[model samples]
Target: MDQQRHTQKKLDNGNIHTSPKISTHLDIEVHGAQVYSHKVLEEFQEEVKYSIDTCKIRGFSEAGSLEVTTVRDANRDRNYQVTYCQDTFKATCSCRMLERKGIICRHVIWIYSSNGVKKIPELYVVNRWCKDEIRMKMFDYNGEATEDVDIIDGKQIAMSVMWSEIHKTVAMLMGKLKADVDNFSSVIREFKEKLSLYGSPMNKQQQLKKIFGCSASQDITILPPKQ
Candidate 1:
């Protein structure tokens, strides 16, 4: 077990040390290094390298809101159509890589690079592949609310954190509890008793506040829709 753990630690350290060297494109290094997770970045870097080496733009055509560029792949001797929208900075490739796997294809990357796009567009950056989304904070170890009280209510954040922590703890122990039927029943009864300890039933407004982490009085700004 110790040797296995040592090997895993060494591999983790190696990935951390070599992650920065994965991206050869300046644009990817600048825009994606901080935003994407390590595995996603590595895949994206591979596409970027493929785009630079084997993909070439044959021709481009402009249609009202879309620009279609034809890219030829030298490796496969195939032509791919890339449609890009200047308004939203959204691009789609005939390869359907982004649609199928949530990773942008070499065809789209080549088109974007040829167009002198310096940064990866926000529309192409999926939330699931982002570093911040993967590392979401679900618990407060210091037993204190976040410092964003002025912008967002601290009580709401605290409630959200607590519920997340509770869910995580229950999930972690569920398999062990299921191994023994009597223990599982006892745990359920204890949970019911603990729940009853919170005296009165919450009103509809209070229940909504607890679940959503926001009151009706909070000024909620709805941003414009993504294209």
Candidate 2:
């Protein structure tokens, strides 16, 4: 019944309407702040400033890895070491800011600024906090790629084909149901009766758990609780 209403609305509109999505890269600082707290953002800014002022790019290795050195205080015995990869846009610091706090540290910020990198890449951004992550193509399902469409472009194509079919089918059904209420009710009732024989459909989460066996609540017996 809900599906019928949803379908009818789209049919009345004549065409499916979709809003354009804003890119995450448009305001990297805003996205970053969403993932990290304001306090962390301030600390990150200060780190970037410190990196620019106090840190120096020690040199680059043969494999395009950069080595950066930073000094927080002259009294400190050891300097911070930052390893950056130009090709992958990945940075790791011995300070473990990225590892522990899941945010870019001062050394990486300095390296990026020194290299004229204007925005943080999506690779370093956490998806749970990003607005654009939902709009992006989903690469994997059940611990593997959907039909092996692992890459972004490939997954986009797969999703486009899927949504197109769904829209077309729903729109067609909606138009039919809107034209004849009695027929629609009769058909839905018959469908429900027939479906009752097979039991109800599994929700998305249940379906995924069945496919991947990753349900946290799955039962396990350990020596029968030492009976």
Candidate 3:
């Protein structure tokens, strides 16, 4: 149903509409205020370290049921007790800027200009979440490249692809990628055997780098610093 509506919208406007997305998340302060308001126009809900501005202007909340945490008071210089999302988030501050005017308070406005973003450091790797980790092979096969195609509902959907939805469709293409890998595994094994027989000059670290292109980080689990 959602997909149908999205398609219909695109057809009516003859344009692809971008979905609202939140900015990077910031850390929760141990003891301080947090705000998250920017100019309105229904951008994305950004989680940040301090109070913020409201982006919704017209009829935002019936009984002001709109519960977004980005509102702050300016004159009294405090925060608002905005509640949204079924108590997942709550704000309690003694700010007055938000009390009288039903407009976006100074608290929410502060976060807007803070140039702040959410601080979730570890990003979600689509490959990690999908069961297609080794499908890294999909990226390259012995340095050979291939093209990506779109398929939908057992039929090839021409030029219709969802960028992030790649993970969702993995179940369908997993078999094909795996088959190609299985068929090529022997070639990889044969190459390794030849290299071993010929006596390679590279060390273990070098080989690791060749396989996974990243410098290894410290393994705290294996070796804790001497206390």
Candidate 4:
């Protein structure tokens, strides 16, 4: 009876109430913080802090557009090779942190800092870790749109795409203006002016409806599964 009661109590509380607290610390702010979830941001910031504090640039060699940098980690007493392309802002580290865990490693962050790159490249920003809701379209074998399209809110999908494009454009421009303080200030000023022209923002309920594609009067209920 005690065991049954304990199990029943756990079921009533659900996962959120039962899960342990996750304590995270943000050391420094980065562009990833805007897009990525809190957990992902925490891990990425740790790498950034590690690169800044413990990693050292041993040397770098150039081959065409590719530059291979040797970064030594004081804590680990290990060397990592980071190959960076100046033309494309593409970087690959021998540690392969991105490949293994979908987080940029300290070695690559050290190289980026040395090269005056302020923004994390969009390529390194994993979509799975991002806070944005990504909707996937399904296609039939005949290349026709599946019934799933009818269920998803087209407006929400369109807004998501438009926001994604705007984000990419802003990220690209920010990277270009990393060293140009005058241009950067002008861009920020222009953006603020443009935003003011949009007038007052939507209320919380209206904003939620737009994002979730649900009417205020819509009923949300869970039904028992079919036997």
Report the candidate with higher TM-score, 1 versus 2.
Answer: 1
Candidate 2 structure quality by residue, lDDT tens digits, 70-172: 4342223346766777777777778887777666776677677666676777777765333323333333444444432225466558877978975776666
Clashes of each: 0, 0, 21, 0
Q: Give all candidates' CA lDDT scores.
A: 0.75, 0.58, 0.36, 0.73
Q: Decide which is better by lDDT, 2 or 4.
A: 4
lDDT of 4 by residue, 55-94 (tens): 9989889999999998899989999899999999999988
User: Considering every candidate listed, which one attains the maximal TM-score?
Assistant: 1
Q: Model 1: per-residue lDDT, tens digit, 1-227? A: 55965774565455456545545745854577767767778888888888888998888899998999989999879999999987877898889999887878888878777668878888778888876563233323333444422354667778889889868767767657556656656877998889888875668887777767887776669878999
Which model is ahead, 3 or 4, in terms of lDDT? Answer: 4
The stretch of ten residues in a row with the least summed lDDT in candidate 4 is 19-28
Q: How many pairs of residues collide in model 4? A: 0
Worst 10 residues of 1 by lDDT: 134-143
Name the top lDDT candidate. 1
Error of 3 at 135 (Å): 17
Better of 2 and 4 by TM-score: 4
Residues 171-198, model 3: lDDT tens digits: 4556576776565667668867887887
TM-score of each: 0.52, 0.38, 0.17, 0.49
Superposed Cα deviation of residue 62, candidate 1 (Å): 1.7
